[model samples]
Target: MKKENNTNKKAVCIMSGGMDSTLSAYMMKNQGYEVIAVHFNYDQRTQAKELACFENICESLHVKQKYILDLDFFKQLGASALTDTNIEVPTGGVEEGVPVTYVPFRNGIFLSMAAAIAEKEGAEVISIGVVEEDSSGYPDCREEYIQAMQKAINLGTKDDTKIEIKMPLVHLKKSQIVQEALHLDVPLELTWSCYKNEDKACGVCDSCRLRLNGFKKAGVNDPIPYA
Candidate 1:
């Protein structure tokens, strides 16, 4: 692994092949930080396609480094639509309550892993693309959860070094995130957010709907293919 020379100014970005994560990585890179992307494959049925998209984006963007972590450990404790194909992915907004697609503590787990890698790589920040508007119903994606996780990382990794979890998009709406990414010239076409692993977005799934609405609100054409 090629380590960045800027010891105090490096960040590990969690890239999920989704617009949010991709934009988050671009934001960090644009900020002049040595950004490394971390992706996870947890035996989800859609993992293969998502991983392929992730790799392509990394290559196209010329990310300095990328790590694809095995997350079969999560499959062993499967309890979400993402890992359980039997559970159909929900389409449209989660109006009533938290949707079934909410992965079980997924963001928390990913952030923990990212923090560990950041500590090892001597990076001070771990950037994640969680947004309050899209992930508002997901408890783990809330501002309180992020703040708590940051504190936990600092305390747990005290022996290693201090680490902060950066949620630059956390407080922003989906439209706002899209606007920012557009401003940063993020390669939105390379992002993959559909729950269904098809050639084009299902256009009905919550993730797809959110992306569509965000792009429309931002007054930008979503470059990805959508059904």
Candidate 2:
């Protein structure tokens, strides 16, 4: 959707309705970019809840432009516990090595699609919230991978089209995320970080544990209820 007369610098933000992503989008908006939110529903276990949170978070952020892409192909190509029902979601404490919940090349796919959207929207930047220290061992969350993806994206696009991939929360710990979100007045309550059991968030899941621990470490109450 092209506006007849628009002069604002634009940013395509990949928001997952989680604290980190919400904070990242807020940071983009604070930097004077007209924020365009992009959310993906890849048939994850908590897809419905995540979608609901995404809507609410977008509304709270006053985001006028939003895209919800359904990558149903991810479900069909499922191998991870998040996309495949056969692989059980681990509930024990965070384990070493790559987590079973890691979606295969999910970020690569997302950034590729986002690059196309950025090219169309004339956006200069694409922002995603990927935490390293606080997350389970997910290979795709590393900054090096994102940096390489950014280089590839710029290289593959037209010479005139330059898009910067921004990961505002990449190096931050979960507690730092919580603190920053509070400072930015982000609607953290509307965010969902649970990997499974979306009705009230399975608090034992890796994602939930990280979120909860962040809030606890920040010495703040998590407004969202947990099961």
Candidate 3:
């Protein structure tokens, strides 16, 4: 959708309807970018809830252009707990090394899709909320990895089409994310981080635990309900 009359800078934000990604979208909007929200339904365990949250967050952000893509191949791959029901999501704690919940090159695929969308939409930026410090030890969340992906994306696209992959939350801890989200007035309550439940957040899940810990450390109560 070409906004012939609009002159604002634009970004294609990869939102997962989770706290981090939702905050990223809001941050882009706050930076005066016309946010183009991109969400993927990768056959994850809580796809419906995540989609609902994505829609609600989009409404909050007043995002006009959104791409809700379906990648069913993730379920066929069946490696991560979020995609395969056979592998149980580890709720014990955020263990060392990569967690079972780490989807296989999920961000890479998402960025590739976002790059295509950005190129098509004439957007100059692609934003993602990948936390490195205090994260669940996912290797793909590293800043270097995202930088390399940015290089690859630029190389693959048209020569004149330059794109910047912005990961503002890459180095931030969850507590910092909470604080920034609050400062930006992000609709955190509309975000979903539960890896298992849809109706109410399973507070014991790794995702939920991180979110809860962030809120606790920030001294702000999470508006979302937990089980």
Q: Quick one: best lDDT, which candidate?
A: 3
Q: Could you tell me the C-alpha RMSD of candidate 3 in Å?
A: 3.2
| lDDT score for residue 131 of model 1 | 85
Segments of candidate 2 deviating more than 4 angstroms: 1-7
State the lDDT of candidate 3 residue by residue for 1-227, as single tens digits.
Answer: 11234467899999999999988887887777899999999999999999999999999888899999999999999899999999999989877788899999999999999999999999999999999987888888999999999999999999999999999999898999999999888888899999999999999989999999999999999999988
Q: CA lDDT, every prediction?
A: 0.82, 0.90, 0.92
Using lDDT, rank the candidates from best to worst. Answer: 3, 2, 1
- Model 1 — which ten-residue stretch has the worst lDDT? 1-10
Which should have the higher TM-score, number 2 or number 3?
3
Q: Is candidate 1 or candidate 3 better by lDDT?
A: 3
Give the number of colliding residue pairs in candidate 3: 0
> After superposing candidate 3, which stretches have Cα over 4 Å from the reference?
1-6
Model 2 lDDT per residue over 1-227, tens place = 12233359898999888888899998888787888999999999989988999999889878999999999989999989999999999999887899889999998999999999999999999999988777788888899999999999999999999999899898898989999888878888899888888778888988889989989999999999887
Clashes of each: 0, 0, 0
For candidate 3, what is the lDDT? 0.92
Clashing pairs in 3: none
Ranking by TM-score: 3, 2, 1
Output the number of the TM-score-best candidate.
Answer: 3
